[model samples]
Target: MKNYIVILLTLITALVSAQSTRKYSNEFMNIGVDAAALGMSNAVVSHTADVNSGYWNPAGLVHLEDNQLSLMHSSYFANIANYNYIGYGMSLDDRSAVGISLIRFGVDDILDTTQLIDDEGNINYDRISTFSTADYGLTFSYARKLPLDGLNFGVNAKIIRRIIGDFASSWGFGLDAGIQFENNSGWKFGIMARDITTTYNAWSIDEEKFEQISGAVDGQNQELPETTEITIPKLEIGMSKKWIFNYDYSLLAAANLNVRFEENNDIFSTSFASINPALGFEFGYTDLVFLRGGVGNFQNERQIDDSENLTFQPNFGVGFKYKGIQIDYAFTDIGDQSAALYSNVFSLKIDFSIFR
Candidate 1:
């Protein structure tokens, strides 16, 4: 118990003292917060107690005492946009599991655009074109524990689509692989790799720049606009570790390090990015209810200015169970440069289990 306090304090101090980091190269608006929050605490790998096991470390499914079902959702405080997610899972037998999850992101409403013209003296108006943008994805997963006691793994695949009215309707696909380590004391370790392969091939508009129009002897002569495809790169590697105490209590902490193979400046570019780490904790009473609180972005600040510091973003939540359903809610920092300051996330999960 005393060690727990020291650990928390050490983490808090590190988070406060570390530099802030940022990364680019991915989107789908990052609604994958189940394991994400746990990962923040570095507790997901070893804390296997729910169907969310499928989302964290598929190998955690072996912790299932019975078959289970689950659902999760989150709202990102980014860009005045709305982000949400839902997931479900069940044990196939004593050694296997399967599930599916969906994520949707609503970019803030965009004002419709139209072209208009008026004669020198007469008033005239006309609509040339109109458009908006939205993005979404669906993921399917399958995982099972091998005969090995300390080793377990799983895989997930995603299909994605993006629609920007009258501009581009893009399509992409990606995959995720995860593993968990479970020991008697409930010490946990997890690793997940996301976005190994993805590319967008259905775009035709560049909102940033336009080609010059030239006047020819024949004004009737005109050139069509040039179109290009934007590519989405692979994001790799995250690990988390957690400890479950004398049954009702637990401690979790984690850090995320992003891999960059290129440099970028666009809002979502892979360049101009950086790595980060965070710490968090959880408490429960009698195995029926739990409360969790912590802060993130331990290593995410500018390096040169010791004078300017960013607050450690905090997260808090409570969870309960009714029959086979697991309900969870959390409050976190949205940190969107374009949106309001605070944001909230709620997740629900159902688990189905079968034991000998």
Candidate 2:
């Protein structure tokens, strides 16, 4: 009991002392996240498992306990878009593990509109059209724990591509690096850096679109508009501590710090991680079924008093394990403003390991 209290105090101290009141990223980049990350308010970096490691904490790859593969699909913002993921991680030997994951975000059947007027000073027709757009990414990860116990590190590099209704396609690449450590006593720490490169390309813009936007006379439908592609750099650091209250129940707590930079905004700022703290306990009710649950807070621009309804405060989740398989679910938020994103994310996790 004392250990749990100490851990809680330490985490609160870290959050209070480290809170940053600076402004940050623009709307577009601020909203990118997979379902699992969104569920915990993205409180990852220390607890690494499942395929979510590809996005939340690459270093988590070091903890892959089995030769397992997982597939997850999430609907975000009340079905505003679709997010799909597939992850595979396997231990090549006792000393190393390799992982691969693919993520895709798609927006479907969007209304495309065009207003046309007749030369006879009368409104002719309004065109209501639809198109589909998507962004896909592939990441390859490698992790190795040094022979020295408790020292683990990993890295990931990803290829990202964007497609817009056959109008255009562009690709870019980025890298992620992470380091983590866990002591037998339950003290855990980790740091991860992501988006080490400008993630998009200006050169990929269709040249044909440039001529029309420049006011150079061009044929109808032959020219489109051109806009600059913007990508920003994001860095995150986190720490956590857990206490084995007993064999069946344990208390866990964690916190994270994020530093974000935008090239175009000339803005530099920090968001003290929302101080994610959760309590989880496991009970093997019948040696075939296990149950888990907890609560935690989410940092935000407004006061989030309700976590269950996704009004954005503390988060809650449940998980079950059966026959080498585990499935988990969580409810959380995505936007920092009045983005009408008050909803819970659904995440399905499966774990299985076999050595052959």
Candidate 3:
């Protein structure tokens, strides 16, 4: 078991170091928030008009009618990882809003077996320790209604923190911008630019702790990992419309085009950028009970036989609202159609006016 633990730790370290050189830095932030949004496969950019908008599309925050708070929690990788989020938003006035949000994704109590076998080559359970790896995101968002009717804009100032126990850590900074527009016909359109200024993370590794595992595997950990990581900008465009029937039933349809500036397996791939399309729907009864579903993450997955197959993720969710408070639940998968395990997500939202 000790040998297995050492191998696991080494693999984790290698993966961390490899990420520093990849285009998807700070990926934990991409794991959407709000169960409602996740259930819709993150196709809510055009209609996320609440506190959670601070993450999906800040411009939606301008629609806030009162001070609001939101919370969400989800477990991933068969409960080996925990993702938590909290957010607060309030109208600064009829035309402006401000919000603050924090997100954390972590794996805790990982066995550190680097020191389990000392110089004498003797196994010592007492020397075994544990540590955790986590990533945190703090965002300050501001939104304002533009002079034009049904136009709003927003910006996000983000700070990122990442830790791998006492072995490595990093701090990053970035900016995001978004805009939304609604037409008299009830058509909503939105655009969100993430890491608009190109986020950068600077890492600091403790040589002492690193050395303990440096020799765990030959030809590995011989060099100090890259000290800097960069994340380029990504864009998402969305559209949505809502229809009411019988004065007691309603339906909302939303779609999103997610773009990354690189070639990938997305349905629409190119050297300049790749686009993944998502579609979602929500059915509501008397504006109190809701059911939602979506499909997204289109990709060409490779099979063991070296053939490529199209795959996507499907999500479903339900919500209830009353007296300015809401509860939501979602069944989602972290991996696309290729994986078997699914995660449960839950979220709560409250309007301060509920207390008044």
- Taking all chains together, each candidate's TM-score versus the true structure is 0.67, 0.69, 0.92
Candidate order by decreasing TM-score = 3, 2, 1
- Clashing pairs for model 3 are none
Instruction: Please provide, for model 1 over 43-102, each residue's C-alpha lDDT reduced to its tens digit, 9 standing for 90 to 100.
Output: 344444456655554556555666555555545445466666666666678777776666
Off by over 4 Å in 3: 1-22, 218-221, 334-336
Candidate 2 lDDT score relative to the true structure = 0.55
Model 1's TM-score against the true structure: 0.67
Better of 1 and 2 by TM-score: 2
Top-TM-score structure, candidate number: 3
lDDT of each: 0.52, 0.55, 0.89
The lDDT ranking, best first, is: 3, 2, 1
Candidate 1: segments with Cα more than 4 A from true spot? 1-25, 35-49, 53-55, 61-69, 72-80, 115-132, 198-274, 299-311, 334-340, 352-356
lDDT of 3 at 43: 95
Please provide, for model 3 over 1-356, each residue's C-alpha lDDT reduced to its tens digit, 9 standing for 90 to 100.
23422443343334334432555689999999999998898999989999999999999999999999999999988899999999999999999999999999999999999988888889999999999999999999999998889888898999999999999999999988888888999999888878876778999999978877897876266777788888877888899999999999999999999987778999999876789999999999998999999999989877899998998899999999999999999997544474646889999999999988
Per-residue lDDT value at 337 in model 1: 24
* lDDT (Cα, tens digit) per residue for candidate 2, span 1-356: 23432543444344335423322212233333444444444556676654556566666776677766666566766788877777777766766678888778889997643323333546544644567878778889887786668766677887777776645676767666676777788777766666554354432555653433333233344444443343444556666775554465554556665554422211222343322233323334443443333233322332366432222344444556565665656554323423355555455556664223
Model 3 weakest lDDT span, ten residues long: 1-10
